[model samples]
Target: MKRKSAKKTKTEKLGLIKNILLIILSFLISVALWFMGTFKDQTPVTRQLIDIPVTIVGENVLTDKNLYFNDIGDIKVNATIKGVSTAIFSVKIDEIVAVIDVSSYASGEYSVYPTLQNIGTAVTTTKIDSVDIVIEDIVTNQLDIALEVEGKPVRGYEARPDLAEYESTVSVTCKASIMEKIAGARIKVNVDGKRTAVTTTTNVELLDIDGNVINDPGIKLSVESVSVRLPISLIELN
Candidate 1:
């Protein structure tokens, strides 16, 4: 009877061990399935193409040592990018840009900083190779100069201070399109052969109805005074 009881107890112990092993195996298998599912459905972030508007704010002063001719006004830039779908979706257009320096350029081509960042993902980023930019020349000209005349020519020859290579006033050139409008130039001339003695300051009109001069109205010309020396022989004849 004792031996039979011992065998039964041993059988019970074996059964319990088997049950525990089975439970552990089942738990491991379930855990493995869960891991596999997660691996197969990996969520990735992908980038999207979008236009990001940027406005640059700065001061314009030619006297400033760092100021550049091309650095005036605002500049526009275009950008595009691609990344993980989730990352791209979460990315804000405003967060992906950087400022560019145009202070060194007086007049010519330029390149602004491109943006690179990972919006939603820890491993990827949307990128722009480089911003293609061009800085134009900024030019300022003085207003028209007040005209003045001096001296006189011969008696027979009259003094024509109005004869200009271009217009009388100094025309200013700015933008390329505006510069094309500059035409005509003129200068005060005194004919000594005509004969006369005179000196006086005059207000010279530098521009024409067409906004041009005889030569390049866009240029500035300086005039001191009008003078003419008339020979005694010519003066007597007059």
Candidate 2:
């Protein structure tokens, strides 16, 4: 009986050892497979990165020549990159930069190809959409800067326009085509809940014919800001 018990205990120990070995072997096999799949350069993969901004290189050259793009239609493009599966999966959208060199081109309409930069050596750009760029001459115009009064004075109070003091005119430099579209420039001042005269300064903004705000960085303003003085008077009702 003692011998049988000893044999049974030895068999149990051997079974435990075998189970542990099988588990270790399975784990090793899995790790080896993962490493092979991650590092191996298999077939090429394609990825489409969208809305990549097309950088306008050498734009200062145009500025020096008093030329600018009238309409840089769709300053963005979709890039198709091809590379090994690992490289494609590792690439980020920001890693790619698209640029178009307009330094050599003058004021005219032209179709140009955008060059890609910062792409990994393992990856190659398979395709990119062409861009239509219209270059126009830059022009400076003198515009009357008007004051825009926002909100109303307190009840029984009136605002007087005679006391307002500000620069009546300003110089605007922008693309000739854009200059033709601009209606005027104005500085916005708020008089909401005001019981007395108020004086303040504010920045200037350009507006289109329809009163839509024009926000173009290339448009340079001689006076970016202005000052305004508001004189309020109390009205007595009979």
- Predicted structure with the largest TM-score when compared to the true one: 2
What are the C-alpha RMSDs, in order, of all predicted structures?
10.2, 14.1
For candidate 2, write residues 117-221 as lDDT tens digits.
877788898999888888889999999988778899999897776668888788999888789889999988888899888788899889999999999877899
* Model 2 regions lying over 4 Å from their true place: 1-57, 70-101, 112-131, 236-238
What TM-score goes with each of the models?
Answer: 0.42, 0.54
lDDT of 1 by residue, 1-238 (tens): 9999999999999999999999999999999999977765456544544544433433253224433333223433454544444445667766754454444445455555644443434435345434555444434444444333334455444444344222334435343333444343333433444444334233333444484543433333344232322222232352
Candidate No. with top lDDT = 2
lDDT of 2 at 207: 94
Report every candidate's CA lDDT.
0.46, 0.85
